[model samples]
Structures are given as structure tokens and as C-alpha cells.
Target: GGKNLNDHALVEVLANEAKNGIEWLKTIDANLSQVGSFGGASVKRIHKPVNDEGKTVAVGSYLVPKLTKAAEDKGVQFVMETAATELVVTDGKVTGVKAGDTTYTGKAVILATGGFAANTEMVLKYKPSYEGFVCTNAPGMTGDGIVMATAIGADTVDMEQIQIHPTVSQETSALITEGLRGDGAILVNSEGKRFFDEVGTRDAVSAAEVAQPGGFAWLIVDNKMVEASSVIAGYIKQGLTVEGADVEALAAAMGVDGAALVETMDKWNACVEAGKDEEFGRTSFANKLDEGPYYAIKVAPGVHHTMGGLKINTNTEVLDASGNVIPGLYAAGEVTGGVHGANRLGGNAVADIIVFGRIAGQQAAAYAN
Candidate 1:
């Protein structure tokens, strides 16, 4: 579906290796159980993991520890709090990295240092219009790898293609998962009316929210949704949710017109029953939000992913400005671009990392041998 929005060759590579990546996770004890739909995806293609209690776990939370433990079991050294400051190039080929005063020389170097979403100076440097937007990235995402690679003549791509997630808690800068919208949650403006298709692409949804009355919207869900999704339940536990006994009460709590909200709820439920969103042309519907104990969370757009970074080939070898591979230098994950062209689809980031990360490791190992 996002073929026109992504690099075709990279999309094919990711598609070809997606299942193998998931299988590798399963080998490392990742308990992926169900497939679900996400925004922009035409079908149920996103694979998610579950915990021992059969509840859905966030993919990053579930996979990181499992992967770390597997690497530890294989005697991989853990380096913490040290940032690589330079890429050591000897005779026109990267041979090692420099962190602080120490130089760790190796036959190959893989850059997995993530993106620059958290680096405000860098973000504004690329996309200046996002001046005051809060970022959802971890603080460590400062583009160290991009800086180092580029300093040593590695080329980059799509440096200005930064992405903002539509539903983010302004107070905590925490991203609300899109699964809520996919599972039938809806967004209402300060007027307590649905404005846009709730499950639209992130950029479109974010732009719509920006054009709303207060530049923010309330994501509404019900107890039934909470019971169905542990991720939503966790947001409630984090105190990000405002609860109400009914629709009118929820409207009052959110400071919107109670009558308008009640009318909106009635119309939305009718649309759900009719299997069509007559108002907004929404094609996805899970269930009606008719249950009691309705919930609302005030959300706005926040910086999420920087879709541009150092350039790399399908083999994961970093490329120079001339489209020639930089010998012994490999990169994967957010540190490299071209996997996503202009806009990235939901659930593809995990696949991008696992697939290209494995490719970088394999290619680097073969180069070393």
C-alpha cells in the first residue's frame, strides 16, 4: 500500500526477509502470537507479542530483553554509557571506532546508533518548522552514528524527512499506540465531534489535529477496549486517562458540550452498525463504543521517527557520496535511510531493524572473514 511512499527495492528486501526476522525472534523466545491491522496497512499484517498471561506486550519491551539475553548467552560484551566519537578509517576503509580515549579496532564496524529525533538542535537543523514540538524518542537518540559516518565521507539520504506521531501525551511526551485507533477508538476535537478519519496516516492525522480548535484532540475509548488491550490498560495505569461514567460525563470532564458529544456518540455508533463511516469515509471499524466507563486522553503531535540518515545498500554496507560502498563500514536500523522513502508505515520499523540488522551482521562477518 505504501509502495509509492517507500523505496521500492528496499521495500522488496524488507518484505522478503520479514518472516525470517520474525522466525529469528521466535528462535530467541519472542512470543509473537497474533496479527493485527495498523494505520495505512490494507490488511492485518502487524505481528505482535504476548506475555505469559496472554496479554499483548509492546513489541520493543518484549523483544529487547529477549535479544539482550540471547546475545549475553553467546558471550557478547555489554558496553554502557560510552558514545562512539569517531569512525577510524585506515587506508580508506573503516576499521574501528573511537570512544573517549579508547580505540577498539576490528575488521568491521556496524553503526546502530539510532536517529536524531531527541536532538533538538539537529531536528531543527533539518526541519525547522517543528521548532517547539516535543519528541518521543529516548534521550540517547542524538544521531551519533550519522555524525560519525558522515564525518568519514559516508553519504546520507532523506535528511529532512522527520515524522511526528499524532497521539502523544504532551505532559509526558509518551506516544500513545496506534492500536487504540485500530481497535475502534476515535478522536474528537474540543467541540466534541469527530473531525477526520480516526485511522488515517500519521502525517494526515497530525496535520488535522494541528488544524483543530485547540491544536489537540481527545482520544476516546471504552471499558471494552481496555479489557481487550493491555496496552490501553497500561496507559490508564500511567494516569494519562480521564474517566467518566458516561458520554455526557466524559464531555463535561473534557470541558466540551455534553449534548454535542452525546449526539456524536449516537451518530458514530450508528455508523459502526452500518459498517461505514458516512461522515469521514473511514473504512476500519472494530466495535461500537457503547459500553460504560468511557475514557479520554488529551493528545497532540510529537516528534517520533527521523526517517533519514546515513545511506546504505541492501547488503547493509554504508555508501559514500559517489554511490560506492565504504569498505568495512555497515549500518542498520534508524541509522540508515532509504528503507522508508517519504512516509513510514506503522509496524514496519521493527521489521526494518530486524531484517537489516541481521543483514549488516552477516555482511560484516563475511567481510571480516
Candidate 2:
């Protein structure tokens, strides 16, 4: 958590790469169209249009498709629906990858298969306490790259440092992006009390929610708050959110104590009116819950990002247990770790892939040539 603070080398690397990634997106018509600022930092997001109930548009959703099309145009082979089972090592060098019974040989290899958050067995093995927690990862994100690399003796760092996002849908576990709260949303517990600052760090908010009666909380917002942001549309369409004409109605819908909910709203509205959240020290009281047509979303902490993986240098070269580079082997993205030491911020993952991914590509190309 303390590892990737302001001006850290890893932060710089991801920031530099993220800049290039944004620039590259422009070449594919996936330009930077909106900036989402949270916790005093900003992230540039690519333009994507989707209806309610649609998946959150990530940069990879646009960038990777364009990159794949471009790569195909250049005669790059495409392998679909296959799993990497092993690393083909020869004379202390990785020569290729073994996916199933077939081996795809190459002069160099770069592993970008993402983290193992979806792998229940691995999750239990690493963090057993998170056995029943929901995950917001694809089923294929089983840490294949980490397994293949480690099979070849690659060293790893921060394997125990996984991130559980503070705001995720209770049923589906989809990320209710921190931007919602950054723009202005308040969280309340079962007793209908504002327990923690809405805009606090992810770890703090998550801990407070887990300490509550049901290990969950409700994010309350008004029509004005909903109108100001596009995220509510998706949540509403997905049936992940509930709406009410007023606080009493909303509380009844959520099965919370109606009187208690009204009292909490009164206190929260007071904070918004006074422009200070003395009760929870919330600095971002952008909107009050006084308007009709209020909404509430049930949220809980769920596994979101893994901050540990194969160790690498600035060049994106994978290292061994003794701090020596593994020739012909490189890694980037979630497969390679140390970028976010304990917890990853919201936008840093995009930055990490962009920065180190390019380095890994360039370095592997140079070595091959």
C-alpha cells in the first residue's frame, strides 16, 4: 500500500505508459473523451457508448480489439480459447509456451495473462479468508501467466497483497467505480447511519462496511446526483439499484429502519447544507438526499485486483529468485507485479499495462532482432 505513493518509480513507469496508451488509443478511434477524478487523482478514460445493463467500458475493451485488428492486418497469428499450461524452458531460457499438448515456439515471450482473482483454488491457497467473497474477474483470469512463469523458477513479489474494492454490487459483484462517490454518493450501514467518510481510502471504507452488521452497506444518492453521472444507468439497468420517491420509501425498499433512515438523511442533508461532514469527516458532500426519487445500492467489499506477481525491472524483464534476469522471458500487466505494492488505486491498472506492456514489447522485440 505504501509502496506506490507519489513519485514512486513504479508510479512513474505506469504513468508514462498510460500516457502512451492514451495516445495509442487515438490512433484506433478510441480516443480519450472523459476524465474521472477520484481521491485527488484523475484518470483519462476512452470513449465508449453502452446502454444500461451494459458492461463498464474499459480501455482494454476498445484498445485490445483495435490492437488485435491491427495485429491481424500485419499477419500476426491469433490463437483463441486456449490455456497456457507450461513454459518451454531450455538451457535456462524460456523458448516458448506450451498450451495444451501443442508448443508455440518463439525467440522471446511476454506473459500478459492477467491476475488469478477468478481462480477459487488459488485464492484460497493465497488468502483463505477470502474464500466466500465475490470476484469481479473473468473466469479465465486464473493466473496462468504466474503459474507458467513460476514453473520456470521466476521470482514473485507481493503475492499476499490483493485488493478488495470498497464498492461492488452485492449480488453480481460488479465494481461500482469509486468515481460515483468521488462525484458524490454517501454510504450508510444497516442502522441507517453514516459510518465512514464516503470519500475515504478504499481500505478504510471497506473495513468499516465489513464491521457493520451484514458486512455490507448502502450507497444513497438523489436524482440530481444520478443525473450528473452516467454510472447509475448501468446499475439501474442491471437491477443492482433500487429507487424510491423519498427516504421513507427508499428505506422500506432496502428493508432498513425507516425512521433511522430518515434521521440519517436529515443529518447527511445538514452536512451538505453546511458544506461540512462533521459526523464522518466526509469532504465531498456534493449533493443532498433531499430530492424526491432517491436511490440506494447495496454494496460490499469483493476481490477486485491482485497487486503481486512476477518480479520485474524497469525494462520489464522477468527476474529469478536471486534477482537475475530470465533471458528471453518478459512480463507485463497484472501478470507482473510490484507496481502497486499493497493496494492498487482505481486508474493505475490501466497505466501499469500501458507503461510496462510497451517496455516488454520493445525489449522482447530488440532481443529477438
lDDT tens per residue, model 1, 1-369: 343755678789999999999898889988577787777766778899876766667888988999899999999998899988999999999999999999999999999889999999999999999999999999999999999999999999988988889999999999999878887899999999999998888888999999999899999999898887788889999999998999999998899999999999999999999999888988888789999899999999999998889988889999999999999999999998888877778888899999999999999999999
TM-score of each candidate? 0.97, 0.88
lDDT of 2 by residue, 49-74 (tens): 33243433444565667778877877
| Cα TM-score of candidate 1 | 0.97
Where does candidate 2 stray beyond 4 Å? 1-8, 39-64, 228-230, 273-275
Name model 1 segments beyond 4 Å from true: 1-5
lDDT score, candidate 2, position 151 = 81
In model 1, what lDDT does residue 184 have?
Answer: 87
How many angstroms is residue 28 displaced in model 2 relative to the true structure, after the best TM-score fit? 2.3
TM-score of 2: 0.88
Q: Model-by-model lDDT, in order?
A: 0.90, 0.79
